[model samples]
Target: MHVVVVTKNTPDTAATVTVKGDGTIDWGDSLVVNPWDEYAITEAVLLKEAHSGKATVLTVGTDEHQEALKHGLAIGCDQAIRVWDGALDGCDSLGYAEAVAAAIRKLGDVDLVIFGRELADIATDQHVYQVARKLGWTMLGYVAKIQALDVAARSITVNRLTEYGTQTVRSTLPAVISVVKDINEPKYPTFIGIRKAAKAEIPVWSAADLGLDAAALQPRTQQLRYQELPKREGTVEIIEGATAQEKAAKLIDRLIEEKVL
Candidate 1:
């Protein structure tokens, strides 16, 4: 039983965002693991603990990505792999998925691949499906609960939350799944884990190592513009009346006067 958790490095939620002259986001020094991916890591850790296996954390980024891998190690991942290639810088979602899927294939004998529903920076929410397609594996998205996993049968059953209702899905091993935060609570790093993570030697793999072509890694999408939205302005008005019924009437009148009703 081997589980691989895919994660991303993202700017802290509270960090101020600005755009560079190139129309690319200038994320400040504050960075952390994608918050949603933490849930996937938690679920993978729990699965490994219950079934006796190893959880490997995988990420695609520059040296800064090592921080996310270290955090994954501190949270209980057995191994961490950093996929970095100069050709991958600013790669589109399709190219990223291709590289990630290639890396996963390089790590043979992997039973499960877990990921967050989306990355905070891009928020396209398309990488998981693209990875699954590239890998030719079953893709389960929006997974809320993992009901059962039969190692011998090499199958897993989960409850997926949908707009209509929860749908039970079962898939065989070597599948890719994206989990929601509702699936599990991520654990905080302990002192011992932190010490181990600090001393851990995470291996970095490049596109060539994964048999990826530099030409294929070029980004298909381009950013036309990046600008911070203007702050919103609003005016508040108070309704006054002698009685509650009168106040209700005044509110209705005001609403109709403003054509808001």
Candidate 2:
């Protein structure tokens, strides 16, 4: 049971968003691990413990993202791999998926690949399917529960959540799975784990290292600018009436006056 979890570093959700002069979100000093990826890492750790196998964490980002990878390693991954290059900036979902797939191929002999259902910042739920398509591997998305792993049968049974309800699915091993937030609770890294992770040397890979062509993985989407959201306004109004009906009438009148009706 060799499990690989893909993770990404994203802007902190709590940080105040800023717009740069060029009109792009200013990530001056904001970064955090994508929340959904945390679940994938935790699940990988659990699977490794249960099945007695190695769990490796991988990420595609700049050197700044090493902190995020370290966090994953601290949570229990046996090792971490990071693919960093300036060209990775502004990579669209398709390009990212291609890069990840290429990296996975380089590793070889991997039985399972897991990913967060979607990245928090981009909110793109395309990577899982894209990677699966590129690798010609089985893909199970929005998995809420992993029921069983039948090594002998070379398949895994899982429950996927949908708008209507949940459906049970059985997919062959060496598959890719995208887990929703409701799948499981993520674990925090312990002090000992953090220390070990801090000292761990994360291997870095580039496009060439993964046998990827820069032109093939070029980004399609271009960010024109970043802008801050408009500030909210607060207004209050009061109306006095002699009866309930009069009060209702007054409210309606106010609504009409404010063009809210």
Q: Pick the candidate with the highest lDDT.
A: 1
lDDT of 2 by residue, 176-207 (tens): 99998887899999999999999999999988
Please, what is the whole-model Cα lDDT of each candidate in the order they appear? 0.90, 0.87
The TM-score between candidate 1 and the true structure equals 0.92
Off by over 4 Å in 1: 19-24, 238-261
lDDT of 1 at 247: 96
In model 2, where do residues sit more than 4 Å from their true spots?
A: 86-90, 228-261
Worst 10 residues of 1 by lDDT: 227-236
> In model 1, which residue pairs have backbone atoms overlapping below 3 Å?
none
lDDT of 2: 0.87
